[model samples]
Target: SRHAQFAKPHSLWLNDPDSEQDTDEDDSDEVEQIDQDEIFDLIRSISDPEHRSMTLEQLAVVSAPQITFNSKVPDRVTVEFTPTVPHCGMSTFIGLSIRVRLLRSLPERYKIDIRVKPGSHESEHALNKQLNDKERVAAALENPALLEVLEQCLSTAGRST
Candidate 1:
């Protein structure tokens, strides 16, 4: 009975065997659903310069990031981004933020290429490299004593002025 059920084409659908009625209507929704593994994969590709154990997604800088696969370039991913604001000075910061995120999420077998669409902020390609440097900057800023040192320096400079 199991074999017959699987073998019979018409058994699954009683009416309109070849019609579209048997098809699922929510293809777009299905396509939009990113698997848990894929989400983790994408998340690991990012690193936040501002905080340890925090990501761009965690920082709420990234909106919906769409990933598409290509048969020709199985090892390459093209990423597109949208910034929070049109004229924010941090567009470069955010773009770099996303670029770093992608690089960290993917494995060595896969290469990531980032492209920020026109009409969004930060059109330059230089931001990609800048993102890689965020970790260093973030680490420097993380030192609790750095603020006190800076304040003392500022006070000394102010007195000299």
Candidate 2:
């Protein structure tokens, strides 16, 4: 069931020894580095709660270039996103969605910083603080109403992908 959630149709393995099909060599022993595109891929498909037909990518909320990872600070990633409108009431909701997406998709060691792009929202600092606050985020996820909305938005991510 887990595999079905994120699987592509193509198979990577080659059964016939004589076939010239080549598989990329495994480098699992090396440190797994996360990059901007990988982070973007993880959250880009999330649905906008107010706009069910559109994805966060389509609304220009999540951009690959806005995501960054520092190799020097392993297991940490920063993602700054813009709300569709400067005063969009859903800014906090969007931030929460991104936070939840990364928390579920990335490994336990990863420390995610989800923030509103500077000057994009009127309450950028406050929203960023709320989103990054472990206790606040946890509490928000526990609310049945917010959780329902989050689940609805997240459900579309899998189908759209």
The lDDT per prediction is: 0.39, 0.71
lDDT (Cα, tens digit) per residue for candidate 1, span 1-161:
12122123321111111211121111111133344335334443243332324444554544354444445966666555554444444444344334433443345565555555555654345444443354643553344343232222122111111
State residue 97's C-alpha deviation in candidate 1, in Å.
2.6
Model 2 stretches with alpha carbons more than 4 Å out: 1-31, 158-161
The TM-score obtained by model 2 is 0.77
Q: Best by TM-score, which number?
A: 2
Q: Which ten residues in a row have the lowest lDDT in candidate 1?
A: 12-21
Q: Looking at candidate 1, what is the lDDT of residue 36?
A: 34
> What's the alpha carbon RMSD for model 1?
26.5
Q: For model 2, give the 10-residue run with minimal summed lDDT.
A: 11-20
